[model samples]
Target: MKLLFLIVLMYMFDQHKGNRLSNNPRPFEDIKREISDYSEVAKKIINLAVYGKAQNRSYERLALFVDTIGPRLSGSKSLELAIQYMYKALKNDGLENVHLEQVKIPHWERGEESAVMVEPRNHSLAILGLGGSVATPPEGITAEVLVVTSFDELHQRAQEAQGKIVVYNQRYVNYGETVLYRGRGALEAAKVGAKAALIKSITPFSINSPHTGIQSYAVGVPKIPAACISLEDAELIARMSSWGSKVVVTLKMGAKTYPDADSFNTVAEIVGSKYPEQVVLVSGHLDSWDVGQGAMDDGGGAFISWEALSLIKDLGLRPKRTLRLVLWTGEEQGGIGAEQYYKLHKMNISNFDVVMESDEGTFMPSGLAFTGSDEARGIMKEIMKLLKPINITQLFGNGEGTDISYWMKAGVPGASLNDDITKYFWFHHSQGDTMTVQNPMEMNLCAAVWTVVSYVVADMEEKLPV
Candidate 1:
């Protein structure tokens, strides 16, 4: 009886393997037909977005917004004004369910600040104090400089770092890898008893300008003044130190941090025709660094999201799921507004069909970076084929934006616009982020791609599987 049972199990296993191989592959003709079905609607969306008044109108409005409000740092009066402006504009544009959700955000001011080389040479350096940094004493902190390329070098020469200002001369490899020094340089330096920390700006190329970003102090570590210096100055300091020169510097900052300020996450929606509760979200952050016009970093992103809705409405097209737009605040300091929204709306997360964000600059439409199940990926691949005419045929997997990351973690499908980010990091958080970097034709193309992808996904018959 045992031998007979073994023979039967072996036969069943072989048959199951053959069936799996045969059934796993989808037919080419079926995929082609699926793509063909959506081709007409895709052409309509693209034509409306590219040649319609919505794109040009959105560009003009974006110019007015950035010029009038300037840099909308979180907790500033400018950020509040920007939010109010969008609220009124969306309502006037005939969008439904426009409102602001309250959020408490961090407030840090960059007062008069300067850095000067006192020893080895007399040179004034360009600097921007990192957000959340503590103010230096009124007289400023003056000490010899210890230069290191990485945290490992700082640890190896820990004793020498004492009673000195550590300068991180780390070169920029990529934003993700090079930004480590800026984010944690202060904590690492403080752990070794350094008086202050100076980090080289995280950009591959620079023209004697410094880029500022947020930095955090680890618990139980002494807080120290931290700031970013120009790439040229960092390299000069490192070269001088290598020649056995005592590089001494004086740093002064009047940065101040106040209590949390009341802010809001601006929201609007175009109600779905069939499934009113089901949602498809498109978003961008409204707050920016205190420098520049914030055009590329988020102004373009925010305006394009709004344009997607405007184009759809003008074309009289409504998807099956509600299309929502969220302009997040306090994204520069961290994803404060987005995190709060996630916590408040987590119970209804299952109703979210898709969340898409365009934080990266909208130079041109390359494709989309999506994160979902294999079945959903196959569906999106077929959908993206409709966009091949505009050179947006690429579809990457496992990429999502910071604002909607919490929802993605909760099993919601997510996507982010993929563009030619060759020059994005160069002007991202610097004074160079103005409307000059934007081209009218490229911006319109980007909006068209965003609109078509969002509409098709929301109109699909079935939800994206978890």
Candidate 2:
């Protein structure tokens, strides 16, 4: 087999006609063999991160970070503190190019907010004012509730929504489908003169928790107070409305939008030996919703990214391409930080081989979801095979992350963590997104997978062709 591989290499060189190797496709078998050669290195990374000294290091780092910082909401003091803390930690870790790049980010604070059902009964309901929501009058808005299950129903009953608080009891279909209600419920309700908008939390299971997220108001449309209600309350309102009972609620929100504030994208890296300019980027957003410790939503993701760099540095493994760890800000606000970073660095987009993100929960590892050319996907398949030691060598399509989507859309290969996210939405953007939701063993496995994939890709013979 060695003689055959050598002969094949010589034949390829001869076909190149001179000194340079051909850019033509290599056999899938050859790629597999090349990737399999990293099995020993893969085992070393896994052992160190999962069973060796570094075990639970990421989780411990994340616990300290999350507990100390609390919640790193964009444009807040906590976010800035988190940025500074990460910068100092990265420098202390001895990673290269540790610094921050400034970004202008939105600032929306959810102040004291409350809701109470007054018509049918005097009952208080849990509420979390959506980000960027305008405040209600000091005394609050007390009006009849108009419950609608879907936008179609709301539009059909447009006349009924006037002088009322529009309550969207949209069923939980999926994040993409249901999140539309949370994001646009205010705008849609305002179109028909709703006094306020109350959207159901976007989750299949909710323990009376109201999930808060960013909501947008259209220009020329009257901005209305908007907030998210727990699933139980949403269902209660719907049930009352179904029985021809009148439900009236008083809503008061102190939500205020301040001027955009200064923030940063914290960065660190391990410079490559052979191709210093070329990069394999690993990242997760540092900013999160203000409701919880923000541990599950992205704290785990960010720390594991740092762990990948730490693991590589511990092993004294420098790849052919630089490995950069970017902790982005303003990711919850539609990925503003990452968008700015992309615009600033896109001139060298060709030098970026792959951008990896781990926004998904750091649950038990499953595999990866990737977006790239067929050739790149083929290469990734071979690389994943090395992870069989951890039993997480699977690859799906349409790799995505709000932070990395900009690069992926511009044709750069992108990869996002895929794990057991069955309970992700249950705590996302809510007070439930705390350290208790995260598991140390799961985090160790996630860090192992992240390190192995990133190191192998960075050290590979050639970039995964875009």
Candidate 3:
């Protein structure tokens, strides 16, 4: 009996891998029975997500949603509007336990801003007020502009930065590396007693649009106004410097911080049947920059997760563990929403079976990057076998999304949906970001992949390793 069972098991496994049984035609009923053994709930979830992507048209749906929500900057009225819309949308999806967790966010308003090179010919530079930046006085500051491409250069020329507006023209080879300038350029410049700082927009491609992100103020350094200039303008400044001409810039901005505003992390859940305590989390941010619609940055990520969860709910396939979707706010500003969510839910980290984040733009699915225990790694390989049909066949050992980083630090298994990001940095943090950037079929494919992974994680009885 044992030998016969082993042979039968090997045959079934081959069939699961799409091998036919000796070219013998089977009845439709027999085929269905065989396929059902591979987790019917997971299959249904993938189908429903694919259907949603088709019906709504991922790009159009994302544009309509982003265009309507507008810029959802943290602590802004628009952000408040976005939160309400998201809450309603989650409830409409019929997700149980849908609610918002309060997160206090610092309010910073970007008032009127203008920059011009007064000396070495009159040249107006496109500028974006960085979040949390101190505004120049009503009179503004007009001073010589010193250009430096890196922190190392600034350190070498500390004397030149005094009483000048240091322009950090650092280029980012990758979004992760380039983003460092946006977060810390001001502090680095201020240490040299620079009157102000201007950073080159962190983008690989741009016409004249400037990118705005958050900057940190160093303790004990005199707080100074800092802003970002369009890539074109930064290049112009560099050209002037190479010519040995002093570039004086006039900057006027009215940015100011207000009292903390009430924000939220939106959550929707489909409860599990057997092990309801275990949960699989998936989501993206609901916020965008104050510039163009943040379609690619995260708006695409938000709806896909929402619609994916909705698809699972519609399929009537309850897994063994719950699937939770989170729509985080303030991801663009500094991941404040993610930080708050982590703080509030860190204690419940053990309950999370697997956490998946999709901050990368909605492009075709490449695979997934995972970080977890050795056992979880082995299970993921098995899971990959199920995903091979959908073209997600690769797995990376060293990646997780920015939002899920907190969970990973707290010992929860985390992963990121790796997309074909060859073009992601071109429009990242720019006005060029919009829904049109994504292909519908590819987005649908991505949604399908997410559904498969999420469902399998939720259905499995054992918690993913590490």
Strongest candidate by TM-score: 2
Report the CA-based lDDT of candidate 3 relative to the real structure.
0.80
Q: How many backbone clashes does candidate 2 have?
A: 0
lDDT of 3 by residue, 83-184 (tens): 888788778768899999998877888899999998989978999989899999899999998999999999999998999999988876877788888888
Q: lDDT by residue for model 2 over 1-466, one digit each (tens)?
A: 9999999999875543311123665677886888889999999999999999999999999999999999888899999999999999999999999999999999988888999999898989999999899999999999999999999999999999999999999989999988999999999999999999999999999889999999999989999999999999999999999999999999999988899999999999999877788889999999999989999889999999999999999998999789999999999999999999999999998788899999989999899899998888989988888899889999999889999999999989999999999999999999999999999999999999899999999988777876
What lDDT would each prediction earn against the true structure?
Answer: 0.88, 0.92, 0.80
Top-down TM-score ranking: 2, 1, 3
Order the candidate numbers by lDDT, best to worst: 2, 1, 3
Q: In candidate 2, which residue pairs clash?
A: none
Best by lDDT: 2
**lDDT per residue, candidate 1, 272-355, as tens digits?**
877778889999999999999999989998988998888888888888789999999999888999999999999988788889
Alpha carbon RMSD to native, model 2: 4.7
Give RMSD to native, each candidate. Answer: 7.5, 4.7, 7.8
Greater TM-score among 1 and 3 belongs to: 1
| Per-model TM values vs. the true structure | 0.92, 0.95, 0.89
Model 2 global lDDT (CA atoms, 0 to 1) = 0.92
The lowest-lDDT stretch of 10 consecutive residues in candidate 3 is 15-24
